[model samples]
Target: MEAEACKKCGYTEFKKGKLGNGYVNLMPINSFFSSGSPMIVTFCGHCGEVSSVSVEKPRKF
Candidate 1:
């Protein structure tokens, strides 16, 4: 969605970075964990605004 125009500044380009899988939280102190899929980092090259898109698709009704 924001790949074309930046949601912050309307830039037509972005920088993409890879994220990891073990993206879960193993902190026992917080007692929270995530066993979900991977994700991507998309940021506006011009305005430095960032957004995330998950590899998993949205659930259907």
Candidate 2:
């Protein structure tokens, strides 16, 4: 998904930030063992602002 506008600078263009991943920490002690999907981080090229959003839809607890 692409961001429509940057909240801070209203910039319409964004660049995909450094490759990032997502993980679930069901328990603090097992944080390292859990696995999940990748996360998308977008940066506003005009103002250096950034946004991190999960690519997957919300999940029920």
Candidate 3:
């Protein structure tokens, strides 16, 4: 995950969560075959500004 800076206030602090939270389970048998995963979307909480967003999936365990 990459950290982002706010455009307006230049603030840097963001939360990270799954793209589809609790929508489905992580398994190979199910229909959900996630070839490429999601990346961390960072935003400024104080100014409510979108600092930066990245979609680079991490290496599978």
* TM-scores vs. true structure, each candidate: 0.44, 0.47, 0.42
How many clashes show up per model? 0, 0, 0
Model 1 gets an lDDT of 0.58
Error of 3 at 44 (Å): 0.4
lDDT of each residue in 20-45, candidate 2, tens digit only: 33443222343554443445567888
- RMSD, model 1, all Cα superposed? 6.1
lDDT (Cα, tens digit) per residue for candidate 1, span 1-61: 4347887888887887556546531223433443544456777778878866545422310
lDDT of model 3, residue 25? 25
RMSD of each: 6.1, 5.5, 6.2
lDDT of 3: 0.54
Candidates 1 and 3: which is better by lDDT?
A: 1
- Write the residue-wise lDDT of candidate 3 on 1-61 in tens digits: 7655667887677655445343432323343455554545666678766555555444531
Deviation (Å) of 44 in candidate 2:
0.4
Candidate 3 weakest lDDT stretch, 10 residues: 20-29
Instruction: Return the top candidate by TM-score.
Output: 2
Candidate 1 TM-score to native? 0.44
The 10-residue segment of model 1 with minimum total lDDT is: 25-34
